[model samples]
Target: MSVLNGISVSVGPVLFKAACPDCRSRFELAAGALRLAIGGSRRTTFYSFTCPECGSAVRKPAGERIVELLTGGGVRTLRLHSTV
Candidate 1:
């Protein structure tokens, strides 16, 4: 536990479980290892990560639950804006 600005702050690494479709490998990834993109629609909303087992880049559609978990876990987020 640490104190910042006179407030108690607890920090820890956040891990998320992910599966790679190409390699069929399942593993846990730290929040820093994941990227979440929220777009205007479900079709555009997704998350991506590099597979540790096969070293392949994996992308998957993120539903409401997924979005909630990833965001709550402190994963980096990118908001997508449409050109139109």
Candidate 2:
């Protein structure tokens, strides 16, 4: 169980589907296995994980919806700060 914005949320084992372009292998990864990075712009926002099959470090672009889902699913997130 978790709380967000004063709302109680159920915490479960969350798994996300991911594919490795290098090996063309597709698999599911747990929330702890993934990392989300929110950047200053859409182009910079993305998620990353290691390919279980090939052990390749993979990164994919994450949009608004992806960010919401990932954050809600309990994936660790890092906010990128940009100094202009």
Best by TM-score: 1
lDDT of each: 0.95, 0.94
Clash counts for the predictions, in order: 0, 0
Can you write out model 2's per-residue Cα lDDT over 31-72, one digit (the tens) per residue? 999999999999999999999999999999999999999999
Q: For each candidate, what TM-score against the reference?
A: 0.85, 0.84
Model 2 vs. true fold: TM: 0.84
Given candidate 1, what's the lDDT at residue 74? 93
Report residue 20 deviation for candidate 2 (angstroms): 0.6
Whole-structure CA lDDT of model 2: 0.94
Minimal lDDT window, size 10, model 2: 10-19
After superposition, which runs of candidate 2 have C-alpha atoms over 4 Å from their true positions?
A: 1-12
